[model samples]
Each structure stands twice: as structure tokens, then as C-alpha cells.
Target: MSYSIIAAELHKALQDQDTALVETLASELNPADLAQVGHHEPASRMAVLLHCVPLDKRAATLGFLEPQEQLAATAGMPVSELAELVAHMSADERVDYFKQLDRERQQTLLKALPPTVRDDLLKLARHAEGTAGAIMTSAFMAIPAYYSVARAMQTLRLKGADVETIYQVYCIDTSGRFLGTVSLREIILASSENQLAELMTEEVIWVGIDTPQEEVARLIARYDLLALPVLEGERLVGIVTYDDAMDVAEEEATEDMHKGMSIGKIEGGLRSASLLDLYRKRVMWLVLLVFANIFSGAGIAYFEETIEAYIALVFFLPLLVDSGGNAGSQAATLMVRGMATGDVRSRDWARLLGREVFVAAGLGLTMALAVSVVGIFRAGTEIAMVVAMSMVLIVIVGSLIGMILPFILNRLGWDPATASAPLVTSIADASGVLIYFAIATAVLGL
Candidate 1:
């Protein structure tokens, strides 16, 4: 169920003052849903839910809450309660929760925590946000390669409570260098006498701890993995799960969608962010485009004398230019989306470009013929020829432009989505108008 349903349940339970109902229901819900419920309601109701659930669940569940709710729930938590929560949290989620706290509160939590655990968390937090190191949880299963299957199984059993996943177990040498990986099924299927090194598969792909999360996600998706090993200066640091990588992929998609629509990144969740914030993010692009629109107007005005000489030319000018822009926008949008999702890569540029050119030529010829027929019927033979010629030229030019803009943007280290519908259409509008008027004036000898 959505947060709305949870909120309704909580509100009804609260009015009934049904503590047992609340506790039982909250336990049944997933952390995400619970977090959303806590976010929708205020501090008073939230505290009750927190008190009822097992403290570990409360802490883990709190990780899912918005930054404001996180602060509200934990600001008054006692030293003992808070320490348990921090201890129970996975390293990445712990650091994320700590990051939302102010400096003074952070110090208090650090003071309460054991020095070793505190240091580990602070070290993890030191990584720049949105990197492999930042996203990876320190919770992982590892064993010495020389350890027997029975011993390795024992270690996994002991550590499984702390680690997020137990499927991929990294094997290390005596010096802690990463040696290989073993799956749970291997351990179960292997003879108990065999050492981890003997059973482990050495051909494993891993990412450097410093690798950006985007690249990590790309690699994981490319390789089709359940988990990827993380390295710090050739030493195994941790592992990032495919689940986490999927989250990164979703974020990348969202950012691209924003750019495609000509809006910059929004600071918070789309539903919760303020109207002013949304407007502020979107207005800069609009203002820049407004100034750019003037340049387009200038292109139109440059051929003002020609338009006056051949008054009939103005009638089809908009139609010709707009059609070109629409075609380019369609092509650019498809190419951009393909590139983002890795459906169309730089390597496929040759094939994609060839296909687009053929399609554009065919479309231009067909469109020109249709426009020429319309022109002949609407005006006369002379004007029809002008219209037909301009139409073909504009469409051909627009088609090439549409196919090229995305590639150029990608090569320039900008997102291809930045060459979105509005921007591409705007370019086509300006360029097509210029091509149309220039072709018309020359053909008519005006």
C-alpha cells in the first residue's frame, strides 16, 4: 500500500489509542512504507511507532525517512537507544543518517559509539558522496582462502547478521589481498575437507573503491552480476550489491529525464519539494532560451526584405521550418534515450547515422511532394516550386542536425538529454527558417 493508506491506518489507530494494533501493523510493513508513514505524520505519532517496534527495526526503518523526519525522530533519543541504533545500522546507511545531523549532534553520537566502530564509519563517510566507497556497506562476508569449507561456513553464519548479503563470499590471502570468491551453493555442494581457495572461483570482476558509483553501476549492469567486489589500493575494501547499483541506475535515469525536459536537478523528492524551488530550477533555462529565441527572430528578420518581395513565401515559412524541427526532435530524442540506457552506444554511431540519413532523405522527398501539391493548389506553379524546394532543403538539414546533436553533446561530456525536444526543436525552428527564406529568395530571384 501507498503512504496514504499507512497514514490513514496510523491515524485511525491513534484515535483508537490502540498500541497493540499499531505495533503489530508497523512490524508487518516494510521499512520504506513505515518511513513514509513517519514522514507524513508529525513527531508525536512517530515516537509511538518507534517505541513499539524492536529498536533495531526502528533504526533501520529510520534510515528510510526524509532528513527532516530523521532529525525529528532521533534528536531526543537517549544515548543508549541512539548507540544501539547506530550499531545496528549498516555502514553506508549509518553515515547517511549521521550526515543529516548537525555538527554538535554528530559529536555526541561519535562520543557514545565505540572507537573502532566510530572510526570505521567516519572513514567510510570520508569518501565523496555518490562514489562506490560511499554507497558500499562495510558489512560483507570474507574468509581466509586456507580456511576449510566447514570453518568458512561457520564464519559466514557468525557474520551473516551484520552483512547485507551472504551469497557472494570473498576469499582473501593471509595478507588480506583479495584472492577469489565463493558462492553459498559451492560451500554446500563441496566436500567439507576442501579449503576456500580450492573451492573458490578466481575469475572475478571488481571495481576500485574510488570508482564513481555511475561507472560501478554500468559495470555491474554490463556484466550482469549479483555483486561486485570493491578494492582500495589493491586491497579488498567491501562489496556493492546489484541492488544498490540498480538504485544508482534509477538516479541517473531521473537526472537525465530532468535534463531532457530542460529542468535542472531538483533538491528533494519531486512530490515534497517546494513550488518556489521547482520554479527556480526551471526558470534559468527558460530565461536562457528566451534570449536564444531572439537570435531565432533575428534569423527570420534577416530575410525580411525577401519576404516582402515575395509575399507568398511567408505563408509556408512556418510550416516548412516547424516540420523540420519536429523531425529532428524525434530523431534526437530517440538517440538520446538510447544512449542513456546503453541501447545505442558510440560504437553504433555508423549504423545509426546511416539509417537516419536514408530515413531523412525518404521523408524529405515525400514531404516535399506533398507540400508542392498543396502549394500548387493553394497558390500557383511558381510558388509551388519554391515551397517544394525549400521544404526538401529544410527537412534534409533538420534531419542531419537532429541525428548529430546527441552525439556531439555526449562527446562534450554533457548529457545527451540536454539536447532535448525543446532545444532541438528550437534549433530546427531557427535553422529551417533561414534555409527556407534563403532558398525561396534565390529560386524566385528576389
Candidate 2:
């Protein structure tokens, strides 16, 4: 059923205090869908909605809520109840939820949690945000290196329910240092008498705890890993599962997209962001671009005599300048996305620039040819020459500027996406004005 219908039913159930119907509805809906329905309810009603779900489902549904909604839904919930909900959560998710609470709430919740869970949450939370350690979960299955395949299988049967994944089991030494990895497939296929160490793949690929989350995602994607082991000085601490890596990839892509549009990093995203928050993220770039356009105006004013002499030059002005801006925006977008995907790098700039110059020249010539026909019909030969020549040079300059700015930003330790469409187009517009008029003055002999 649609979430709107679910929301309606949920609201009615809550109003009638129909505990049986509420539980039935909660069981029928997925945790994510349940969370979506909860989003439609007021904060006061959200806690009640949560309470109607089974305990395990309640924790899973809470995980699906936005951080603010999570806080709102659980507000004034007893510490012991809160602890039980948190305890049911996966290790990584538990740490994330705990970190969202206020300091006092966090302390109380931690104290209410079981000792083992509390220590695990504290260790996971200690890792800096946006690192492998922060996102990795400790709920991974690890077997003793000395265990035989039979023993390992027995261990999985006994303890696998408590772990997140069992497909790729890790092998560790007595001191908990990572020894290697054994896939469940390999273990099941091997003779029961074979030692796990003998059956395991010793060439295990792993990342350090401090690795950037993006790098972790890249590695996981590159290797098609179910989960990548995280280590702290040879000791296995946690595993960054593919699902977590996918989340990092999505967040990074969204952040880059926002930057591509000249919007600053928006906290909590558009739906959750306040009006003022949206304004703050967008206004600075737009206001700066407004001031930047003044340079385009000044370039026009500087060539007032040329414009007056050949007023037809004014006819092609918008067409010519907009062409440059559009071309530049296209180029900037390609370069930005290329750099983001690691398809392009700083060292490749020179080689790419050489190719870009040839490519831009061909593009400029083709555009110049297309516009020259309009130039001839509108204002005859001299103006056509000026317009055509201006198109070629302007396009070439714009394309080069678009292609180079991202590299410059990258080299300066800034995000290459900082070379946004508006920023590139603004610079191109200003340069187009100067290039068009300067070519007009020379070709028209004014």
C-alpha cells in the first residue's frame, strides 16, 4: 500500500488505541516504509507510532529515520527503554544514533546499555567522522586461526545470529590480530579436518582504521567486496560492509552535485533544512556572481564607441556571449565529473589540455560557421567577419578556461567541483564581452 494510506491507517489505529491493528500494520510494513509514515506524523505522535511496532522492528525502523526525526521520536523515552532499542541496533548504526543525542542523554544512554555494548559503542564513536573506523561495524564473524573447517562451521551455527554477515568469515590469532579470511563457500567445500588457516586466503585485502570513507568505498567497489576488514596495527577491529560503502558513495555524489551548482554544503539536506539554512547555503555564491557580472558590464562600457559605430554588433552580443557561457558550462561539467570519478587527475591536465585545445578549436570553428550565416544575413560582410571571428576566439577561450579552472582548484587543494557552472559561465561571460568587442574594434577598423 502507498505510504499515505499506511499513514492514514496508522493514525486511525493510534486514535482508536487499537493495539492489535497497530501491531498488524507495523508487521505488514517494512522498517523504511514505517519510518516514512512516521515522518508524516507530528513529533508527539511519532513516539506512540514507534511503540506500536515490535521491539526489533522498532529499532530497525528508528534506524531508517532521519537524525532529527530519530531524536524527536525517542524524546522523553526512558533511559532503560532507549538502551534496549539501541542494543538491538547494528554496531555502526548504534554509534551513529548515540552520537546524535545530546551529551547528557548520550551519557545516560551509555550507562544504561550493557557493559559490552557500551564499550563497543564508545570505541566505534571514538573514530573521527568520515573515516573507515567510524562507519565499520564490529558485528562481523571471526574464527580462531587454529580452528578446523568443522569447528568454524560449528562456531558460525552458534554465533552467526549475532553478527551482521557470515558469507566471508575472518580468521584471527589468539590476540585478535587478523590472520586471513575464509569464505563460507570455501569452508563448506573443504574437508572437515582441514584447518581454517590452511583453507583461508592469506592475501587478504584490508584497510586501516583511519582510511577516508570515500577511499574505502572506492576499494569496496573496485574489488566487489561484501565487506572489507578494518585494522588498527594488525588487529581486526571492525568491517566496513558494502551497504555502508554504498551510503558513503551516495553522500559523496550528493555533496559533489550541490557543489556543482555553487551551493555550499547543506546540513540535513533540502527536506530537513530550514529556510534560513537553504538561504545561507545558496546566497553567498549568487551574490558573488552578481558582483562578478559587473566586470562583463564594465567590458561593454569600455567599448562604448565600438558599439555605437556598429550597433549591429549589439544584435549578436547576447547570442555570442551566451554561446561561450553554455560551452564553458558544458566543459566544466565534464571535467568536474571526470575528476570526481578518478577518470581524470592533476597529472593528466597537460595531456588533456592539449587534446582540449584541438577539440575546442574544432568546436569553435563549427559554431563560427553556423553563426556566420546569420551574421551575413543580418549585417553584411564586415559585421559577419567580426561576428564569425569573435565566435571562434570566444569559444576557444571559454572552453580552455572551463577545462583549466577545475585543475587549478584541484592543485590548490580545493574541491574541483568548486568550478561550478555559474562560476565558469560568469567568467566566460565577462571574457566573451571583451573578446567580442576587441575583435569587432579591430575587424571593423573603428
Q: What are the lDDT scores of the predictions, listed in order?
A: 0.83, 0.91
| Residue 98, candidate 2: alpha-carbon lDDT | 90
Q: Could you tell me which residue pairs clash in candidate 1?
A: none
**After superposition, candidate 2 runs with Cα above 4 Å error:** 1-20
* Candidate 1, run of 10 with poorest lDDT: 265-274
- Compared with the true structure, the alpha-carbon lDDT of candidate 2 equals 0.91
TM-score of each: 0.88, 0.95
List the candidate 1 regions with Cα displacement exceeding 4 Å. 1-7, 14-20, 42-48, 72-80, 309-318, 341-351, 366-388
Q: Which lDDT tens digits does candidate 2 get at residues 1-446?
A: 77678778978887787877888877779898888887777776778878888898899899888888888889979999999999999899899899888899998898899999999999999999999999999999999989989999999999999998999999999999899999999999999999998988889889999999999999999899999999999999999999999999998999988998999887655767898889999999999999999999999999999999899999999999888888888889999999887889889999989988888889889999999999899999999999889998888888988999999999999999999989999999999999999999988788
Highest-lDDT candidate: 2
Question: Candidate 2 has what TM-score?
Answer: 0.95
Candidate 1 residue 285 Cα shift, in angstroms, is 2.0
